[model samples]
Target chain A: MAEERTPLYRRLSRRHLFRLPLLHSRNGKRRWPIRSAGINFALGYGVLFLISATLFLSFIWWSSTNLLNDHVRAFIETDAQELRHRWGHGGAPALSEAINDRLEQNIDDDALYLLIDRHGRRMAGNLPGWPVAVKKMNHFYELTIRRYTFTTPAQFKAYTLPHGFKLIVGHDIRGRTLLSTVITRTLIWCAVMISLLAVGGALVVRDLFRRMVGSIARTASAVANGDLNHRIALTGSETDLVAETVNTMLDRINRLMEGVRQVSNAIAHDLRTPITRARNQLEEAFFSATSPDELRTAVDRAIGDLDHITGIFEALLRIAQIEAGARRSAFTTVNLNQLLSNMAELYEASAEDAGLSLALDVTPLPSLFGDERMLQQALANLLDNAIKFSPPNSMLTLSAHPVMAGTAPGSGAEKKPQGLEISVRDQGPGMNDADILRAHERFFRAESARNTPGSGLGLSLVQAVTSLHHGRLTLTQANPGLKVTLFLPLLPEAERTGRSTTPAETTP
Target chain B: MRILLVEDDPTVRSFVLKGLKEAGHNVDQADNGKDGLYLAIGEKYDIIILDRMLPGGIDGLNILETLRGQKNNTPVLLLSALSDVDDRVDGLRAGGDDYVTKPFAFSELLARVEALGRRGHNESAPETSLTVGDLTLDLLSREVRRDGQKIDLQPREFRLLEFLVRHAGQVVTRTMLLEKVWDYHFDPQTNVIDVHVSRLRQKVDKPFETAIIHTVRNAGYILRPTQD
Candidate 1:
């Protein structure tokens, strides 16, 4: 029923498996045979198998034929030696009698003998006459002779005896010839069998390869068609590695796409509120304002709201730009010591005004290559958050030191430091586990920070700047406070020096 | 002061023209880059405010480059909607004296324009010492003295005072102070600039009988000999 359910052309093609065309047109487009890796693999395997099998069979045929020829030559040499001795002891007549006796004693009837006189006339032999082709004495030759009713091919050796009599000793090789012919016939049959097996094996291999890759191809096409949920099923085969890697990549892409979607949604929600608020305020002022002062106050407030909205827009655009790595070109050799101190001094007065004491603990460090302005901005955001959350008289500790890669916070490893760790700890109502996990998400305001007057993009911008520097940002609860650490890797000398210098602005 | 205003948007152009005229400046208006360039070249203006994107074939940068190439030394402040740092760099690299992104407060524009106008007049001679009322700033010694009484200041504070004293009687915004004094460009989330100015005021104004650094509501800070 299933076979009948398929299209008629598919069913017809399925019946003639061997006649399957390597190249077929689908939807009016010709599919190239070479495009199929399975077909290429099968062809290569089949050709190699055929060549090796032919060589092996040829080796067997040559060795077997040589063994049979050697056996015949050994027998002819021994028989000729014994007959020559007989001719020497009993003369030509004795040799002729001996040759007849051997012929009569031959149970297999494969013996051949011939004795020629000085004038080259055959005296005693199974052959009709001296072979005209056997012109030399003491040499082996092959000739046909009449054994009984049938003529058979035989190997012979002509030997010169006393009184110029030539005695030719030979053996009938019809059995050996038949055996060799049978071996040749069997080898040919085997070659044909091997060729058939190779082709069948190739088909099996190609089928397996296609089945493995077909799953992946189907999943990819499904994804291309907007079905991102489709995934290649793992078959526990060697191809599972590739399938797993592809699945992992798809998961990452899905996550990124989801992030983009969420950001768009958040932007719409975030921007709409202020815009609606501003519009409503202006509309209300237009209809109700009876005095210029009242109208002016309403307009000023609207402008302030608009400015706040603009600030949010600028922050979002900067974060997006930084995440896109567009600001990397502005990287330069920044003196960390000077930068940290300047930032500390710049923000110290603000922290003091907020009734918080700011402490800076920066160890002597080498120069860092980065966009000083961006790093400063990130630090400013962190400090801003710290001061905003901290209670009066609380100490905001901003510290920086060198750290080795892979070493956790406060772990003292003896290895050389490979990166810089800058942390800001604030004594505030720290975030919970869930909020900490999502603190860097754009527009994610923590419960403790819900009342704070911020656009909720501070940490996101910090995250963007950290990632742009090939760094990692982590937030951990510092027992009574929260600690935000930015771990920036130290670029190697080659990378630092290899950067192309951007053109500087000329003074007018 | 004579000012040239080049903007394509009628709303923004009329608003800026009205503001400049109200501020007692002779203003020349052009709706496109072609007329703007012609007016800028034909007249000697104290400042030229050029919009980055114009309707005509010529652009703000093109006019700027042509003027600079001809050694026209009038300071040009670029008004643009492109707010990226690279865009600002491109504008400045093309001989723009300053860049103000769109959606700007008129006060910021006026402040920057007045600053640019003052810069053209102040470039004629270099002064070793600047005096604003009783406040004196020694350029060679990096010393600031009020009423001939030496006032010790930190290195950063001296630079801040020098910038303020040089642009005396001008409304200097927080961004200007941040860029000119700290050599950094970015908006601090909080009023950090206010804190710094307060610190400066504590030393320069708190002890003195006269206050020099006065905050302009909704604008920034202005350092004058006397308060308004």
Candidate 2:
């Protein structure tokens, strides 16, 4: 019912959409080009660059234009001051003469002067008559005036004289306007060049981004298509870091895939014997048994064989479940000292029955947060292995002690070990280096152990339990015996108190 | 013992039915959760064997919760194909008295079912001591005596004997002893339970004229008075 409630496209897109390339839709149609991250990044960079460039150019234009205007204003004020000074000394006649003198001395020929009587008649200046736009006194204005034969825009300031006469001092400002025009044109050209450069830079950046992403995508797609060997090639750039990380991840996946293949093969190979034996026994009982009792015995034996097969399956399932961390919810504070001693006591009788003496050496240990049963099972498996391989009248030692920070041998230098070190040693035929290396693999048995009775999943289960606790398991050849050690890290305070479920830090 | 078995798988259902019938239990069967819930509510049974996954609208946990909600105190044994520890915990947390994983040996199932059935009838006043033949165990003082002669036992052995004596004359599996006596639920690779039982036997029966603890082949161990 829930499946029917969801639309088909929604269901389909939820799983497969992410694996598809950004440029294409699920139906093989071309998607919006800007959806690509590289193009989007480039477009965003271009737009930002253009906006900032526009703001900078606008500021320059505004400031430069204001500077030019201030220069024009200063010239007008100084010229007007000279005229007013002359007016105070010699009245309108000297003021008029001074204006004429300023106009004559102006090299740029961009000066203008106009003097008017109260009756609105022009006295003397370059202008033909008094312009009506200059009505207020001591106020600056821009007005068009006829200077000789040409009309030009001028900045002017008007002043009232002693006999109600008016004087206007003005500057042409044509050169300033031309300079501003040149600046405006330059700014426009610069803007055009900046835009072109921005586009070019964006294209380069997009290309680089695409190259980096494309290789990774291609490698991923290849792997998805069942080509497990495909890998991203490093370009020796800063992106090589990402490339190396991806490559390392691929290697890990490849190894795990290999492990799965080996496990499946081993399961098939190992299970076939018991199954065949059970079938053969049942067939023999059905065809050749003389009495019901004989048939019953055969059937019972077959059932025993079948139970053995089920035991193997159960062990495998338990290992998988532990590795998947499904039992973490059952975690509680477990005292290692108590657990180890209990295990030793439980196995001491078994060890004695096999004519081997089990010695326990334990120090007072801090409690750890873990599934106590799983840890017990792991310890039991280790002790089982030790006793099984031990020779008659030999000593098997089970030891537990706290490993202080940075003290455990062969632990990573960067890892500060703060956990318990539990080891089981047996004076038996120690395994070679190769066997020790492959001991934890599923269903891996050494040549020496071929005749021994075991499912070959003991160490694998132990490894799984250790991993579940974020711990490490190591096997070493102790001269004439084998020593198996488990280093279980202590859960942090938060995890121990059940306030947080963060996984404990792993120690190598 | 009156038992109700709810299982969807025909093979497992018949196997359990035949086994229960042979064991002299009055059995009521249901092939689906709906019928199982109906029968469970309509009739009274001493023990209920419910499968975790059922085909009908109701599941085993739902029935268990409903039965508990109605203030029914019948012991229920949960059967499931999920053998994970979490699944077992979930079944027990949902008012199940015991849990048996699928593909289990009939002896184990029978042991657990009988244990649950016996637990239900044990609602009487608690006993300070248990007796199987001449052997008497004092619970409070943690003491054991045989026919007037005192026999000392380690703490673990005393607890083991206590579980066996409480369920005297009934089959108790190794797993049950491991869980109840030791408070641990794990399968040891070796015969550790057998060794411990042997040690307990050496102390409890080796010097005695009669042996009370007998191994029930392919099942587990049973504690009963020696037959004449």
Identify the leading candidate in terms of TM-score: 2
Candidate 2 lDDT by residue in tens digits, A334-445 = 9778888888888998999899999888777778888898999999999999988988999999988777776653334355448888999999998999899989988888
| DockQ values of all predictions | 0.56, 0.69
Error of 2 at A292 (Å): 2.8
Please state the error at residue A19 of candidate 1 in Å. 33
Model 2, C-alpha of A496: deviation from truth (Å): 12
Worst 10-residue lDDT window for candidate 2 chain A reads A1-10
Interface RMSD of 1: 0.9
User: Where does candidate 1 stray beyond 4 Å?
Assistant: A1-260, A406-415, A494-508
Candidate 2 achieves a global lDDT of 0.83
